[model samples]
Target chain A: MSIGIDELEDLAVGAAFLGTGGGGDPYIGRLIATKAIQDCGEPTVLDLDQVKDDDFVVTVAGYGAPTVQIEKLIGEGELEKALAKLEQHLKKKVTAIIPAEIGGSNSLVPIALASRCKLPVINADGMGRAFPELPMNVFSFNGISASPMIVTDEHCNTAIVETASDRTAEKITRAIAIELGLRVFIGCYPMTGRMVRECAIEGTLSQAIAIGRSIRQRPPGSCAIESLMHCLSTIYPDRESRVLFTGKIVDVQRDTADGFSKGSFRIEAFGSGQSAELIFQNEFLRVCVEDKLVAVVPDLICVVDEETASPITTGALRYGQRVKVIGIEAPPQLCSEQALTYVGPECFGMDFPYKSIATLEAEAADKAPKSATAV
Target chain B: MSIGIDELEDLAVGAAFLGTGGGGDPYIGRLIATKAIQDCGEPTVLDLDQVKDDDFVVTVAGYGAPTVQIEKLIGEGELEKALAKLEQHLKKKVTAIIPAEIGGSNSLVPIALASRCKLPVINADGMGRAFPELPMNVFSFNGISASPMIVTDEHCNTAIVETASDRTAEKITRAIAIELGLRVFIGCYPMTGRMVRECAIEGTLSQAIAIGRSIRQRPPGSCAIESLMHCLSTIYPDRESRVLFTGKIVDVQRDTADGFSKGSFRIEAFGSGQSAELIFQNEFLRVCVEDKLVAVVPDLICVVDEETASPITTGALRYGQRVKVIGIEAPPQLCSEQALTYVGPECFGMDFPYKSIATLEAEAADKAPKSATAV
Candidate 1:
């Protein structure tokens, strides 16, 4: 429940740990958060209990091609462009700006805005981990629409859409990004602080900090992976984590379409006796063993560099790079028919049956789910 | 100024002629318009001058992937869904619905709703010919913004984006598409009859009908291109047209990102000792001769099957398919730095100097501008 200034760094690192590969580079995110904290002083962490249901809250994040942001470096005040419009659309004073998720650069984007906007940071996110779609947010799962959404790009171009359905808003956002040549910034999902508190994955920022701190404090020869495993065990005790593979990337192919990075990579065993190929659209959604489907979409598949333990994005996945692939059980909420139908195996074009991440983890865990129903 | 029911068919053909090969398939568009007319009777066509500036006119068209609409056909009540949101956003009665552009499909989309919604159809459009960006409408060039836009997909999903800027509205729309898995549907833009009249390419529906009729009524033994060229001469003697080359498609590559099918193609000359490479994003903008730039961006570069005379998209361009390359002048407004800069050669990664389609035509006519200072 408590997140300190120094812990922000740890949280980012840990969020990167949960990125499941392909959230985008976290360097800009870390630097931005660090700068915000140093300049604005530490941000006060607000607990869920403090937020009244009627208190206005806004969720902010960057929306665009990760590859483009790395080069263009969204101009200063770009996030503000969308925020300004959001304020106009809501016609209410915003009490806080919450990070939509904890992953890659997005983990830092909210920090950048909060430092400049003088808003408190919510210690929760819509997704417990990360997802490619806006509607996939836990807030949406909890019955909150992402409408009255404000989106913008660094060029100061902003849009505020009040859609009858969140899906329409999603289409509009995708189209505008395409029209802008595919890179944009966005502040969306304006809700009451109470709605955020009730719907969000609570205490995630604090959890991220703990996981990050544990990894950073670990001594040499102590596996960073083991530290993460230990930290997550405390927070997600019912769930299990498994080190899927340790290998060197052999090939990486990527395509950026409609603000999503769709691609795949092949990895050869470095020391282990196994090799694998991973496929994804924005996240490492599926993994295979020698062309045979092993673990599929909606199951968490993260690849971190073996040495630094940094998560690798699908776009950044390169040949000749050493990585440790990690698999973790997805939250039970993500296993609902609606959730699986969207981010599951069928959504990504696999004919295979839906299998829970717990099932995959069982192959590596000393003990596994009894019936494979635990996602 | 004079347009008949048969003229509408010709205009549809001509609009497709000017579409430069990247509007959604016109067949479905024609069918939709035809069916709407059959069911609801003819739409009342209003001229620009007939519409007052303050008149509530909304430009409507579909937003999302064309591929999806082709499969599902648009839902019957979807337009109503979009209109409901639009009416709320405008907070006024929509007196008329106008075509934003005379593209293959959208040119007729409004027709489907004309009688059902009891809204008059304006003969004008934002773009006389289709251009990808929403703001590319002449209305925008004339100081009208595309904000307060209404977008609806086939799923009865509707959204209203009322932003201070048109570009911001576009960004929101793009984000929505990205989130919705690239669903396609209708959208209304720049909600003022005056702006609609000024911005909507005037009499575009009439143009489409004329062109369609001309192509269908062409004399036998006259190929599609020759017949169309004759039609062009008759319709627009002020704008010169040239059959640049007759060749066969050798290669085609497409990248559908950001709602635009952008990329390039190569064609082998049939009898001429030359080959041409063309690049396009939404519309064919640049063409090169053996890697040396021949036609710059901002000018129209179109490819039609030599015998069939059907326009081919860069995505549909295939190897060994016989094609005829044609060049035409763009509107003077599109030739300006403000317009050309958006779709120019540099935007497409070409290093050629921007030459107006008029200037290019002038060169072919021995009337090329002799001095830079002279307009």
Candidate 2:
């Protein structure tokens, strides 16, 4: 389906809602996407099955510390700069653009690229949630390389990297980010539609839109606990979604180093007379409720306002604000030992082993395992 | 004098010593400079007035937070990235290179550029003593524009900017740095030898080398207090210099924002039952001794280790370091209202009016002023 002018905001909002709070802010992304869509005209989304086996699809996103972007706004035409160069290199019309990850600002980045290039945006993403490193994506876990990658920044600085190994891409990307200045607009991960379709998380855009709409139309005075659980139930039916303690943010300790937002937050529990803390490297990976480890790495921990049910982007969450913390099961694909190696609690300085969100919840329940639910 | 392999180490050492702790660590910078010298042959210094009026010149330096550079070392040839692009853009062979600033890593940045381009280096700079902002430089203050600048990062992101205003150039350059990821290499300030002669600080390189050598050759048990005063007295025989206090740092606070280091520091007085505090934005502008304002801005308030005679760059002066703080009369040119308006104590966040460093020193002497008596 092709996007219309009015649908841009909806799509951008949806994308940001699903960003799970680690993407850079979506305002710049939205403006650029809107402008690109206006310039190239509204584009359509191509189905994975419709794309040929060899069709080349490139994933694009901004790389660098998010803190810098707020101080120094991006220059014009940087996104299209790398895109134009990539197209020139390929000498082929890009059939579609795909979101590499669903986090704060990047969720909308691919949509913007697709709208600007007048190409369809694939319905899938490499990560079901946000991650700090490049190779942590599902595609990389599936043995797909991140190289032959063309990365660029707003200054029109570009690099065509052909790495010896996919792991090298992370180092190269980090170095490039450091050299470029810690924040850059980048385009990478060129893959065929078939490879992407098999590796990517499908229908994330629709999922994000639905989540955004749910929050937007949330009933007044209704606890986000029920609405979010209802939404999760729509996505995962068997397990009963539990409402974690409601609390006010007491502190948000953040340090942007080595191209990642490495920090944690503490929340003083209000009604429950308990405190909650979450630790993260790019995305919320662990949550501790009342000094008990309620959730661990490989689980998806999200924080939002209790009243509004609106998702809080990681960077936007600050102290003295009331929020409702929620935890959900990460897709089984991300629970592997390899996946845990890069994004697990250990990677975030947690002195604990990886525990699936489902397993953690079931352990908390102290009951028989329920039927497996498909997402 | 040409920089040969024989003197590159000495030069690099001298450059780092002169950097006064702010240009970043000289390890990687020395490597790059040495490699460039080895690769492109020795670079010779050219006197500005000696060049023809039509001779092309450019300034080269790294543009970004120094912290970013330390975390991710610049890639090979990163310094030449912007220079190469600028050379291509102008279609004119750059005959010489000059340093835009002479503090921190910037003091040595030109060595790499000049060696790589096989260009003669100019012995002058925009600032005899470094000021944080681009417009505060002598070149900019003297009506030389910073536009037509080319900025790039190791990622090969290149930006060619020409602005009507120098402030716009600063903004754009900073934005591009942010885009390149916060660490960028820049080649800028394209000007003719005539402009260079008119606006540049002549013999700054020689000055730094002399100052560095003197600091290094201090006699045993000789305080930096005597050595620095001797050096400055020799350099500026016409100017007055006074040691305000000899003490160790007790408290230091700083914020690196808007491309300037703005902060304050306090120290416990060496002998008296008192303390001293100084406030600054880029340069040491104010000093208060025992809650009494002792010195003000448009003056030079340099702090150095009492024993080592090593000058302390503002950002590098930390707690527990014994230092001898000196107050020197600024040059007549720098004592003007224009200079004070740009760098006075008020500009940094003090509530006092400008006071001449000489007059302040006279008041502090509590004795008869010496008249043209060389120490």
Candidate 3:
């Protein structure tokens, strides 16, 4: 399969919806990928089964404050430059590219770079959804080294980090990204095709495109919520998807600290006089209704425009915006005991235990007819 | 010549004196070098004239807050680990190691690593005396690239920085050092023996040892200052050395900020009613007597114990301690127009123009009979 210029819009929309209000805004990414495809032809999307065991595959993404990406536009050829540097360091040609995360701008980053470099992009990603830190990805969770990672800026300055552990790599890379104007392109997790097949979240790029196409086919204000939820459930049969709340944003408190956008938002039910709160650090980590924990990571909590069905990132959220909150169960691999220990709510300093969206919904049903249940 | 365990003490003392209150304390470095030499025979010290043009040489130094060096001691084999990583990156064997700066701990770092790795220590350094920032070194001022620089911490984490400009390399490296507990070991400025001979301050290591021997040979408190000055003048004929003041420290205001010990010290003359002030950032940068500029960077301003002629670093300074202030002319290359722009008073944010110590001394002589002229 090849992703041509015509499909970029759908990819961006799907990626944005999957971003869970993190991964940064995808509009610019869409434009960049579109232009790259137009200039260099469509990028080939290689299925996992097609990858040779010995082929070299690398994940590429932009890391920094999403807010900065809006104003400090990336220069042309930045991604190519970063990928070239990484190839030089490894002294091996890259056979394929993959997104570190299949969310927002990160999803399009690989596609753009692939078109420019004429390398196929693997139809999978390290993270099924957006994550703020480097170690939160599936590859790192599976013990794949993030070392020999290359971080490059628009100015062409490059730094290659080789750390003993993934946590150390994250610390050093994050610090360097912050130092380099809070935005840097990173080429990391250079693994063989066999490792990619074993560690990656399979078919995420195609899943995102399918999800976007499903949402786009529905009328803007007519049963859009139901249609979107139906598409998610059909695409991820094992994962639960449902609307958590429909309300108007009442208040928002956010601040960029420690190289992350950290804060919370409150949403009031349109006519019920009830409110829900969502806490976040780069991505929405937890959602609560009337002080009751309804959802937490690694479950996805996405905020979207109630009327237009367009996903809104945390950086783009504003008070008084009417929105629909939704939660989707994470992939089974991500919720396993070992993976949860690293990406669970506790990792973000939350004291509560992890609970699936399905469990939370069942508990809400048990308290039906009450003034305000969790869901 | 060889530097056995017997010579480590003298090397530390001389290096500390040359540190000008920066480059960290050398006591730990001496111990490390002594142990390494004791374990693996004496390390060879190669003269610049003996180096072949094609020989690969690298400067080794510890960069971070001097205060941290005292409390968070380095683990054994840390320097060797960093050197091994750099060699792996360059894909070639390093023929010899040189000190990045002939100051405090940095001066002995090469000796310690060289002894453990069985490589010769070059009798030269990038900076004749320590300066806080990386670009202040003669290698950078002379247009040598600081690229492919390796930064390693106690945890065995390493990062290799390659940048278009030396300033960018320093900025990124400094930020990483701050992130890694305010100290990191750096192997940078990989150059050929020919480049080292052309840009390095040759024989600095031996000069430091001779200076240490001169001070060590002096009786407890008899004219040690004059003897030390004589040794310095004889070693650096183009440079002038003189006593600027002999006084008790009345006040010392120091704080560690931006990974540097920055502050000022006030010295009141023992018998006269005159006082002088010294401002420093890692190293003593400027001095004024009665509010008149006496000396400024890139000239050397050193503070030492008034009685023992022992160099006292900024981190060890205490109020009410009697000290001797001495000034030595910087090497002519360092004081040239090109170098001064990066290491001069202006670079330190001082508004005054740079004046040679010779010129300042002549002005002070013409103002004799005045109550308080700049020394």
Instruction: List where candidate 2 sits over 4 angstroms from the true fold.
Output: A5-40, A49-96, A103-109, A130-136, A139-199, A206-297, A300-329, A347-349, A361-375, B1-41, B50-95, B103-109, B131-136, B139-198, B208-342, B359-375
TM-score of chain B, candidates 1 onward in order: 0.86, 0.85, 0.96
Candidate 2 lDDT for residue A360: 66
lDDT of 2 by residue, A262-315 (tens): 788999977666788887666776788766688765566677787776767677
Q: Which prediction has more favorable lDDT, 1 or 3? A: 3
Candidate numbers, best DockQ first, in rank order: 3, 1, 2
lDDT of 1 at B258: 70
DockQ of 3: 0.72
Question: Alpha carbon lDDT of residue A206, candidate 2?
Answer: 65
Give per-residue CA lDDT, model 2, range B1-375, as digits (tens).
Answer: 555655554444445444434454455666777777778877888766676688788887766665466665667766666676577656678888998766656767787778877778888777665555556566666667776677666655555655556666676566545545556666778889888887677776776666665676666777545765687678768777778788889999987665545678999976676899987655666788877777765555677777776667675779999987777666555556666665556655667778776666556565435663333
TM-score of 2: 0.62
Alpha-carbon RMSD, candidate 3: 2.8
Error of 1 at B182 (Å): 9.7
In candidate 2 chain A, what residue range of length 10 has the lowest lDDT sum? A366-375
Error of 3 at A245 (Å): 2.4
Please give the CA lDDT of all the candidate structures: 0.69, 0.68, 0.87
